[model samples]
Target: MIGHVGFTVVVIILKKEDTMRITGISSKPPLLFTPLFPTYFFPTHSDRKDENTWINIHYVEQIKPLKDKKCKVIFVDDQTITVNISAHSMHHQYLNGIYYYYMMDRAARVATFDPDSPIDYTKPQLNIYEALAKYSLFEHK
Candidate 1:
């Protein structure tokens, strides 16, 4: 399967280990949640604001299927990790069996994904899958 990734990341500082922080606003010293989604730092319309409010969506960079692998004996003496790999796609389980066409082709105007069960969907990886599955146009047989 081939697809493109859209990034909505919040560009922050460049620290050691090549790190990145999103557009969350900082509060306490040794900051708690900075530039994250649903931050009151921006205009947040919640259920408290109205009966039908737009849900705060957490944006992600991409759903990269990791096809890269490297193996090395960093530590010895029974410190071995036999990497059992599998070929798989991403997006939350809730988006199970959603075809790719319905997503990008039709511009995603009318579609709904049944959330993956046993899923908290508190994160992007989970949320995307459930959302994607609503449109089965790109599902695999």
Candidate 2:
């Protein structure tokens, strides 16, 4: 049977090498827990699996702090869950989740390009000025 460390290793492997690279760049190495899906789930507490509470970044509507140093996370569907973490800490995790999501998205976009695809030479290429004019904010008469 695979132990905890073995399971974690498998997860890291499945997540790809980019996860480690991103963790290094962000200066926040995922310790005991890493996001199952970077864009979807993030742990409010990452130190221990027993204490960790995963939240869906997309569904989070608001985070409110309680008097006892905990946070209440409200979801888009009006569901709320109180986690034993400070509001500031929870917010930090939320922001980190967003950052990871964007990083993974950018990596995916870059990795999907087909270098061998033939470029259509018949289509005229637009210069910087023409491209800017075409997408300019100001309306043209």
Candidate 3:
């Protein structure tokens, strides 16, 4: 009789597993899920990934178009930093626009590359510091 009671208790414990399963209402839609984060089902931050690396718009001096849908970006601070990027890249799509990247830590939100107005490097009046202050992902917090 004691062995039969232990077997019944095991069956009761196994039935509790159904409570953890998701019903029809709570599951996320297929279209809404993107592979932006490395792990969607299980989030682990053991690997420190560069989430949102940004560039200052005012520093963009020249954008030389290259073959194979690439462009050579000329950004200047004390010196020039040249980066070859894809033309279809979010950065390339919003060229000369006010955008900043993460300096120290990963950004919490997606960096807004799309701006209202196109960036004009010829305009000396454009304030680099102000743009950084306004659009930097860190500033949003």
The sequence of per-residue lDDT tens digits that candidate 3 reaches over residues 75-126 is: 5644543334554453433331221122211222212343434434357565
**Clash numbers, per candidate:** 18, 0, 1
Segments in model 2 whose C-alpha atoms lie over 4 Å from true places: 1-9, 12-18, 25-39, 47-49, 113-141
Report the CA-based lDDT of candidate 3 relative to the real structure: 0.33
Question: In order, what lDDT does every prediction score?
Answer: 0.24, 0.57, 0.33
Candidate 1 lDDT by residue in tens digits, 20-73: 121122221011122122221111122134321111112222233334532211
> lDDT ranking from best to worst?
2, 3, 1
TM-score per prediction, in order, is 0.14, 0.59, 0.26
Which tens-of-lDDT digit does each residue in 43-114 have in candidate 2? 766434577766767889999999788989999999999998889988888876677666544443344343
Please give the ranking of all candidate structures by TM-score, highest first, separated by commas.
2, 3, 1
Cα-based RMSD of candidate 3: 19.2
Tell me the deviation in Å of residue 19 in model 2: 2.7
TM-score of 3: 0.26
TM-score of 2: 0.59
Better structure of 1 and 3 per TM-score: 3
